[model samples]
Target: MSGYRVGDIQLDEPVSVLPQAHIVGNIIAPRLRVAGMVYGSTAAHDTIILKDGQIWGDVHTGRLEVAAGGRVQGWVSSLDSADYQRIREEGVVPAIEPGAATAQDLPANGRSVTRSDAQNTLLRRLQDEAASALAARVELEQTFDKRLQEVAGETTARLA
Candidate 1:
């Protein structure tokens, strides 16, 4: 990809992805004009998808214009009118700032979980469940083995 950034990019003005350019990350801006391909979502006050332009992720904007041959593969949701105007006037999203977000600022409902964090959390949970299941299986096997041995001993005694 030509304009692939490692993380999200925030812009104060309108941004355009040129015809030959492709971006792999999310974009945050007042407006976006795409003439190329974007692999990630976009949050902007206004978005125009030119001919041949494609977006593989969700688009969140107040106004969306798509020319012939343009395409978006994900959901498109219009932003609140007030928030759209505020971003245009302020040059930034109202609820988000340009700094590191603290834990307190992040919600607890897993909305802000990164890919790695989610993967780690899932791995740990699966491991714990697997261990518990294995322990239960072992206990069940032991109980069956002891019962079988007792039955065998009684049968032998009766025969003798």
Candidate 2:
């Protein structure tokens, strides 16, 4: 489909949601290719999300391939035994409208996130990891040196 649609979709054959298309409900298909936007969950045997595609709800598929720039805002999981039943009887889950922000998007600290905040967090983690690795290396060198000294002393005593 290449336009906007507003209902649940169920099909046995392969399905494609082309660019500029938008679907506002769940999709149940054996195979799917999405290059547009989906505002609801999808259950498929194979699902491919091309660049420029976006899915705002959960996806359950046996095999999934996503190209760079594809976006899925919800959970993704492999299909389970009960997925078939879900595909047949499931309803669409509520989705946040495009560009809308929800409470979940907020940080637990209740502070708005900025580019500096992200960069600072990444820098802190890297610094901590570097310090930890340096400490480990120092400890290993100390242990090796101590063992070597003990071995040298023992060898001298045995030779004497």
Candidate 3:
């Protein structure tokens, strides 16, 4: 869509927001290409592409591609291919019942976990997040190269 403002968009198929479009709430889509601005969360099963777009909240995606001028100011969590496939098949992440057991509350084998362990766990999680972000940037560079190659090929084909 073009030149529109929306709130809380959810999609089961592919969707794209053209440049200058603005979305004020969450978006859930199989594949999403953002060329505008999104002020809230986004979850994509296949991929999330930001081409000169801006996002101010969390993003959860299978694959991510951000162009040179694109900007994101919040967290990004990448799902593995298997997770993406599952999401595609199920249409949404599995529902976690309220008050479900979590690492913070439960210890493996009922062992007593301490505050130090929690701090260490947090540290590790942060470290992993940093690594994931770095990996995403690397993947973006690789994707850019492939895109450049495709563009060159198209140009050559047109000339021929």
lDDT of 1: 0.68
lDDT of 3 by residue, 5-27 (tens): 44576666887888876665667
Cα RMSD for candidates in order: 20.6, 20.6, 13.8
Q: Across residues 53-96, which tens digit of lDDT does each residue of candidate 1 receive? A: 88766687989999999987655767976766664555443322
Q: Give the TM-score of each candidate.
A: 0.50, 0.54, 0.50
**Top-lDDT candidate index:** 2
Q: For model 1, what is the alpha-carbon lDDT of residue 147? A: 100
Candidate 1 lDDT trough over 10 residues, lowest sum: 92-101
Model 3 residue 124 distance off true place after TM-score fit, in angstroms: 19
Q: Which ten residues in a row have the lowest lDDT in candidate 2?
A: 92-101
> After aligning candidate 1 to the native by TM-score, how far in Å is the CA of 70 from where it should be?
0.4
Candidate 2, residues 1-160, lDDT tens digits: the string is 8665767898878889999877767888888899987767888888999999877677888899999999876656678656655655654323323223444675777546533545555654554454345445545666799999999999999999
Which structure among the candidates has the greatest TM-score? Answer: 2
- In order of lDDT, best first, we have 2, 1, 3
